[model samples]
Target chain A: MSEAVDAFNIMVYRQLKRFVRAKSRLFGSIVNPLIWMVFFGLGWSSLFKGSMAKALFGGYSYLDFLAPGVVMMTVFMGGFISGVTVLWDKEFGFLKELLVAPASRTAGMAGRAFGDALVATIQGALILAAIIPLARDINPGGIPVTLAAALLTGFAFTSLGITIALKISSMEGFHIIVNFIMMPLLFLSGAFFPIDPLPEWMKVLAYLNPLTYSVDLARISMLGSGSMNPLIDTVVLAASSLILIGSAALLFREATID
Target chain B: MDAIVAENLTKRFGELVAVDHVSFKVKQGEIFGFLGPNGAGKTTTISMLITLRKPDEGEAWVAGLSVAKKPAEIRRRIGVVFQDPSVDRELTGWENLWIHGVIYGVPKNSLRRRIRSLMEFVDLWEKKDTPVKHYSGGMVRRLEIARALIHEPEILFLDEPTLGLDPQTRAKIWDYIEDIRRREGTTIFLTTHYMDEAERLCDRVAIIDHGRIVALDTPENLIRRLGGDVVYLHSSSDRLEELASMLSETGLASDYKIIDGKLMLSVRDASKAMPEIFEAARKLGVKISEISYKRPSLGDVFLHYTGRSLRDSEGSWKETARIVVRRRR
Candidate 1:
């Protein structure tokens, strides 16, 4: 047990050090969501407001509806790119050093996912901090729940990223695969729009996406109103996070080193 | 007890057998070398023994545990430095060593002190705060050696440890390796194609080629197997085979072969054989253009066993082109 803990802590420590050292990555993750909140959220919100927007956003403004989505998007995009670090390690040969250590592969990968998730959640929190003043209707009591949703979203997507990273060898292949999977999932998750107004086929995809549960949960916590019950959103997001984490661990355990 | 043992260990990639049915035992605290040219199964054999790759045909044991059965146990007891550099370039030297110690389960209290002493030992103490990307190649290699010892493993496996380094740095790295074995009593297993490195550092060498070990013995014994000195006789006549037969029949040469249009003779005493060799060449009307003899080297033994010199096997089309371009100039 101590062995696993040691491996896990050290991997987290390593990832954090790498994340902090790259100043641009730190600055960019925070700035990215703010751009979406300002350009996309406010831009679209101005054109669609009052009773029609209130009906669409459950009495909240379009900016308030878009606030939680932007926060979840920050976490989602941050977690999705976590595997690029793993791919770099593989390319630069650091993965061999990690793999040959006495520590379990599952522990190492879990540590990586946890570290990535933590960074992604922090980025989400920063975006929330920025959004709190710009967007009204955020319940101060639901801040904890919003952070929890961010963390869970981070863990799920980071694990998903790592699972894909373990399969793809080259950077080009990783970007191609991740971007291919990411664009559809992001658009289909109803982050940019309401799922209720979507066509049946698009609504089904939104329901099927794990990101949808996270976005819904974030919406419930921040706006105090969402499409699904808060309990259902929480349970689905938690289950998907565990499933993705487990899959990443299993793939890491069977991964071969050269 | 042997620190490591392999019985018919083999690994294949698609149709290519990377490591053949190779077997050897590394005794406790001894420095053993796998000497071979590129793609000669050295790295594959080390990978199998280190538990990175499983043997396809047979099993191996490391630190008394079977590689196939107890790979985790073996990993805990052994340290490896791969041929390619594997350090985290973004991290400081100190951070890299600290992470390595923690991951290896070294007690947190002692890890800092251990990392300090290791850094000092490798002469990287002053540069510990610097990121590895800024480090020289030699400094990174030393840092890796220090990191590998973080666990104080019983056996250390280095696959081409000093490859792509200058002679001075290679020798310096060799000193560090010897010091590790002498001070810590760590059994060292290294692979290299450099004859001088094998002769200087290893107690026993296994000459591997074409996915097999063709010879295994102490450097002296392996060289001694060549019988005596190597006599290089460059004859004016292209019919070197006729001269080889004459020298062999006259008992002037114990063994002879035509290499690069030169009659290479392995003789008991080159001085005694030289006069007789000249007489034989005179009788055949074949004038000896160049006559030189030297003590047999590991390269000669490799040639004697594999029928090819290690140095001569590395000529590529690019190298040939460079030579042709230089001649034109």
Candidate 2:
């Protein structure tokens, strides 16, 4: 049992160390989410100062409403991009090394998911740190809970990402496939805008999206502008995170060297 | 007890049989070599033994545990250096070794001690902190060898370990392997198509051809089984092949072969057979332009069994021969 734990910790340690080693890769991946936050936050500035804005935003600014969304986007993109490492490992033949090791593949998968999610959470945390001072009515102590929610969501997304990347053999194929699915998952998750005024069909997609619940959970904790009960939102995200992680582990056990 | 055993092991992909009913055994602390050309089932057999691929028909045992029933136990006792580079290039050399040790459940102090000794043994101690990506090809291979030993496994499996390295580097890698064998008495199971690599590093070699063991013995024994000497005959004759059959019928030579535009005849005494050989050539109107004799090599055994050179078309000869035989039936 201790050996299994050691395997998990070492795999996660390897990922984190590589993450620190390749600053350019980390920097390149976060660039897109940074652009989304800056452009959208500036474009919608000064629109939430009146009492009419209070009803719409629950006494928070548009920038604050979009802060959690943008942070989730960072974590979301970070998690999604993490799966490319598996493809890279497969291409470079390092996956064979890990598979032949005495440790369990499930342990490696769990550790990888943990490491990528934590690294993604760092991006989410950095975005929050940058936007918190510029925004108003922020709770300093609530940051940990919000980050935990974001990490759980990140783990869920990264697990799903690995599942898809397992079937894809090339980096170029993964990029094309992720772009097609990610944009739709992001836009329909009520990320850039609330789902209040969307068409009936679009609302259902937003409701079904696990990303919507994750972002909503963070918004409630960070901005207190949530549309649903925080408990229900947290429960849904946590349960699905477990489900996705379990599924990822199952698929990982069957991963062949071929 | 045999350190490793495969009983009627078989693996197939669609219509192609990658490893067909192959069985073998490896004794403890022995160097076992599986020699074959590309696509001759060497990799498939190693994969099955190491539990990387499951056998379709039979079973394998490593360290006295059935591979199909207890793969984890076999994996725990074995170390593998793949034909491809399997080290994490992003990690430092020391870090790669450390991760392997940790995963194998090597205790901290023992792991540290083995890492120190193995790194020094492989001459990679100075580059332990360098990321593996910057290391040259030989350095990465040496570092991988060090990593595979960090866990102190009983049996080591190396697949084409010296495929693309320079000759000097290849010799250096073999020196490290020899050092390991002398110090730990670890049994090594390596697969390679390079004839000399099997001759140089292995105690016993199994020559696999078309998913079967065509020959298995010490290099000297297999070569001796071919003949004492190999006579190379290069002649000018439009009917050289017909000349070969004529010579065989005239009690001059049997099992003559044409390879690389030269007629090779395995002779027990080349000097004693020279008179008859020249007379047979004279009768067939084929002049022996150049003739030389040398001690037989593993190459002769390979040709003797498969009737083709290792460098002959990669897996094509086997396919063509199989098709012709099938049509003949």
Candidate 3:
């Protein structure tokens, strides 16, 4: 078991090392969300300056309202991007090395997910740092709480990415699904708009989206305002991510050895 | 005791039999070569023995552990350098080795020492800190060889370790491989269609064709099947048969045949036979294009056993593997 843990750590370290060395991916993840925050947020804020829009943000400026949402976006993207890398490894033959290693594939998969989650979480935290200079409404003490929420959110998507990528044989197939799935999850998660104002059917879908919970949790922690209570939101997110990550591990075991 | 053993191991992808009733054994500390034509099940066989894929039929044992029942155990005992390059190009040589050592459960205290020795062994110690992307093809292969031995596995499997390398780099890689075998006495199993590589590195070569082991023996024994001292005589002479008959009538040569537009003769002694053959050609007024007598090689052995030269299978494994995968999909 200890040996497996060691192997797990090694696998995680490999992913982290790769993520760090890439350098561009780190800066790359930040640029997209930063643009959304600066241009989209300012543009949308002016439009929302009307009475009909102020309540949607709870009187917080559009930048202040969108900052936490942007952090969650970073976490979401980082996790999935990390998960998609297994396909690269599979194509290039590194996964074979991991599979042939004495360690458990579950441990290896878990380590892979963890490395991605850690990188994603760090990226999320960097966004928070960037946001802090612009958005004064963020609670200083709630930074750790919001970061934890980002980490959990990253794990859930990272696990989902691993689970889906494990079943998908080709990297092209994975990219299609990622591109297809990423937009709906982000747009519907109440990141840019209010879930309450959405149509009943869309609201149901928004509630079903895991990113909604992640965004809600991070947004509430940072802004001290949200649709759901922090405790309940965190509990549901934690439960679902655990289940997703657990099943991801199981799927990884089946895919690797069999 | 044998370091590895396989009994009637077979794997089928639907109707295509990738490996059929394949059985072989490698004695401890011997360098065994698996030689075959394209898509002849060499990688499939290696995959089975290294515990990457389970055989659909029969059993294999590596380092005394059953591959079927104790795959993890088997995996722990063996190291493999895959046909495709497996190094992390982004990581430095030192980082790649460190990650491999950690995955293999090497202790923290000895990990640095082991990495140092392995780096030095492959003569990459000076460039240990350089990213693998910056390393040359020969350097990457050497790094992979060292990575495979990081855990001190009982067996090391190399799949076409020098596939695209130049002759000089190939020789350098072989030197490192030989150094490993000499110093560690690890049983090395490699797959190659290159006859000379097998001749130079292998104690026993197993030649497979169409998912079956056609011949298994030492290089000398395989070549001996061709019989007699070999002579290469490329003749453009129109009366080639007449010249061959004239040479044979002299009783200087025993057996001869026209292979690939070249007249190949096997004689008891070429030193005494070459002059007589040249005199006969001169008397017949035959035009000999190119003639050179040399000892038999593994290429001859492959030809004698399989009726096809190793050159015929060159650069086909990749295409074959791609087809196999496409068919599987």
Which candidate number maximizes DockQ?
A: 3
Mark the 10 consecutive residues where model 2 chain A has the least summed lDDT: A45-54
- DockQ for every model, please: 0.37, 0.50, 0.62
Q: For candidate 3, lDDT tens digit of each residue in A120-143?
A: 999999888887887788998888
Best of the two (2, 3) by lDDT? 3
Candidate 1: which docking quality band? acceptable
Model 3, runs deviating above 4 Å: A256-258, B228-230, B234-243, B246-252, B257-262, B267-289, B292-303, B306-323, B327-329
Model 1 lDDT per residue over B38-119, tens place:
7677888988888887789988889999988998888889888989989999999999999888888888889989999989
lDDT of 2 by residue, B104-200 (tens): 8999898889998989988899999999999999999998888888888899999999999999999998888888899988999999887778888
Model 3: lDDT equals 0.84
lDDT of 3 by residue, B218-256 (tens): 976776666657778887777777777777777767777
lDDT score, candidate 2, position A70: 86
Cα shift from native, residue B244, model 3 (Å): 3.0
Candidate 2: C-alpha lDDT: 0.83
TM-score of each: 0.87, 0.87, 0.92
Q: What is the lDDT of residue A156 in candidate 1?
A: 92
